[model samples]
Target chain A: MTKSRIYLSIALLPLLSVPWFFGPSSSAVVLGFPIWALYSLAITLLFSLLLCWILQRYWSLLAEDESDVE
Target chain B: MSSEALIDGGGLVVMSLYFLSLIGIGLAGRFASREESLSDFYLSGRSMGLTVLFLTLYATQYSGNTLIGFAGRAYREGFLFLMSVTFMMAVIGVYLLYAPKLRRLAERFEFITIGDYVQHRYSNSGLTIVVTILAIVALGNYVLTNLKAIGLIVEAATGGVVSFATGIIALCAIMVLYETLGGLRSVAWTDALQGILLLLGCFAIFAAIEFHYGGLRSLGDQLSAARPDLWLPPSSAQKWGWLSTLLLLGIGIAMYPHAIQRIYAARSTDTLRRSLQIMVFMPLVTTLFMVIIGIVGLSQFPDLDRAGSENITLLILTDLANNIPGIEILILLFICAALAAIMSTVDSALLAISSLFTQDIYRRLRPDSSQQQLTRFGKILSWAIMAAMAYLAIQADATIWRLIVIKLELLCQIAPAIILGVNVRRLNAAAVLSGLLAGTALTLFLMLAGDPIPSKPLGIHAGIWALLLNLAIVFLVDRLRRPAE
Candidate 1:
């Protein structure tokens, strides 16, 4: 894998677990969702956009043959 | 949620017409067939373009569970089930790990079944057979689950005018007839139609609920006041479960045999790449909509018991049909979409099961069999398997989500063999074979051992633990094998 692709994957993992980091507060709401719920949704959308960018930019790199990997 | 017929005279007529159109497409697909070879039967002559590929993948991946089961889960679990959208996207994310290399290799090898890939990569007969058997069992369970859904929908839609057993038998016959007539070409064509219907269905219901209940903001306010626990952050245990679910679904679903075939069937690498890029955004529309609808149901009908919650989507629809003027048409559309979702998944799995049995097991036993003979046997196999699964669906009483977990657990065991095999050239047949066996054994032990052992220890699924062990063993075996060589 390329250094950039590896870095992107690492960045993506933490975003997937965003729900785990918040507290039990429903005191705040966003567009009909609690702060944590809405936060998780926003992070998921960001995760998807980043994945799309990775797919478009680094697809050829990811698709390279095993011989090219470190 | 009473046991009343949701569809009567005109509704029955529309549903019948929909059923007949599928068979019509089957006949059309047969005429469109290029040749009688297994390659043509299973992979559609390796000529699928972007639209057909995308729709087929979409329809095949999202089953009736996405429509009904997901809504029910959301109703029961509250917002924690929003993880449904994340896990689905994870399936697509995992696809990127190996689909590109696998697609190129499949084209070079002219692969027909997933077994063909395993056999080629490992050159080990035992490993190939084991993997194929694992795939068939998992897929067989998939067919059974969907078959039960079809039967329940028909029985409920008709208010017992057509019994559950009758529903299973009739739909099974329709699926097998179309499948045997046109093969994957017919299945993909039907899937495209079904995919469109599914999208329309989800959107219609989501709009109705959002408009009827003010908006998400209103619903959120109500939910926050009524069920404060739902708005709270996940407990530590729930966090572990969320991460575990992502691993199981992400890795397991990408390894589905029919899903692998779609990669090989693509007309070009660009077609496959574009289809998957578009798929990354589907969860936003498909799963997120269902999650919202489920929450809507929870807010509307707060007193339903656990079993009643599973039918929350149906309850919401039935309530709408009774009250909303001009909404019956939309309900009919949703019904057809639900059937489309169930039938589309069953047909693809049936085709995959037939190809695996004929190519992997039968042909291995009889090397002299020609492609014509194998294709003929595959047609016969689809009919036989569908009959057996339909019968089991009638007799069985297991819940759909439990069946889903069992299937994914078995299917995920084969991931190391396929995913690791593609990426690591030095990963040998023995390493994969040992890892697969160890993982499967551990999963079964954990699953069957009750009371003394919790089903999901520390809120993580048994399958996830087994998978971690499986991956560790694969690398360990590879390391040991290197020095010996």
Candidate 2:
């Protein structure tokens, strides 16, 4: 696997771990957002930014093989 | 005219024009394709750019259920339904496991369908056939469930002027017409428009809710006072439930036949990667909005029963149109967007089924058939499948969530063949085939024995249990066979 792919996968681990820290909590609101909602939004934003970075940098390095297209 | 009557008239006209434009795009797709080939028909000649690819992925991933069924679930489950956002993102995350490699292989092999990949990887016709049948059945259920949604939406939006039965038939007719007209090209083009409308509609409704019910602060305060339990942290068991759902939907959705076909349809690796990067964030705008809308519904209409809550989004739309000033246009647009979501899903699933049947089953049986002949067969198959599904949809009474769960239960079984086969070279075809059979059998047995939603014999999802056994069988069989030697 490429370095970026591995980085992306590791970044996704926190998304699943959301249940551990912020699972179904409504008592605490962060900046007017529920704890769980805020956690999710933060992780999603991180994921999107990381993915965009990977695509712009590492993804273009992969060689394209269009030999099979008829 | 009354407000309801005005909505019905305006919504019907907008939706009619929307449907007509879809057919117009289909005709245009037909004219643009220079050759009659399966690749051209099924994958739009593998020529999709970034914008169309991203939107098609968005449209297919977030169906009408995202708008209607998801909100209902959120209204029913409360803050716990925030798991919906996580799971939707997990679908994109799971793609990281295999999509890059699969895309490379697909380009090299010129793969058109998921079955093509299975056939190439396994070289076992039996395994290929079993996986293909599972895909077809899962996708068939998808079409049936969405057809039911279309009927309900039309019936409700038209204020019953269009009966449920008539609604199903008319929408199915239009979907099959355009799908048959230009195949994937047409479907992708229409999906772009639908995806945009869906996003707009979500924002419009969120604005309308704020307009009608003050703001999120007021709604949250009301909900906290009325239903404090909605905010409590999930119990250990419920947390497990959340994880199980994430795995089930994560792996299952990425393996969707239509999704894989889109992966193949991507014009370049960079295009596919960029599209997926954008897709990673859709849950925020789509599923998250639906959950918020549902929560707002809880505060606005606190006494709704379980079934009544599913209509929360639509009911809110109706109320807003009737009561709110200068919001009638937004209501009509939202209705069209909801319809767009449902139709986009139905058309994509229909096209995937037809391609699976044609390229994998029929063409395999008749290897001598020309590409043109196979393409024609696929078009006919699309119409036939839609007709059968429409007929069955009228009689099918399951909730949208239930129907989706049933499909995912079976579809999840194929994950071993797709994901494992792509990543693990030592796993033999026989191991994969046996694992698939055992997993599917177990899932069906458990589903038929009791309540279909919850996992049996354990707190985990039934499909996850089946998948565990499926993975076990694959590993055990692979070790015994020693295929690497």
**Residue-pair clashes per candidate:** 0, 0
lDDT of 1 by residue, B29-68 (tens): 8999998899999999999999999999999999999998
State the C-alpha lDDT per candidate: 0.87, 0.83
Report residue B86 deviation for candidate 1 (angstroms).
Answer: 0.8
Q: What is candidate 2's DockQ?
A: 0.30
The Cα error of candidate 2 at residue A20, in Å, is: 2.1
Q: How does candidate 2 fare on TM-score?
A: 0.93
Docking class of 2: acceptable
Can you give the lDDT of residue B389 in candidate 1? 97
Tens-digit lDDT track for model 2 on A1-70?
A: 5745664564466445455665443568655456765665576666656555655565534332233332
Looking at model 1, residue B469 earns an lDDT score of: 88
lDDT of 2 by residue, B1-485 (tens): 01244365555776788889999998988887868999999999999999999999999989999999999998888867877887787787677667877898999899999999999999999999999999999998888888888888777777677878999999899889988888899999999999999999998898778778876676777887767777666777887787788788877888899999999999998799989888888888889889889988888888899879988987787778679777778767877888899999989999999999999999988999999999999998888899899999998788788778879989999998987777676669999998999999999888877665544455677788999999999888888888455
Model 2 global lDDT (CA atoms, 0 to 1): 0.83
RMSD of each: 1.7, 3.4
Which residue runs does candidate 1 get wrong by more than 4 Å?
Answer: A1-11, A68-70
Candidate with the greatest TM-score versus the true structure: 1
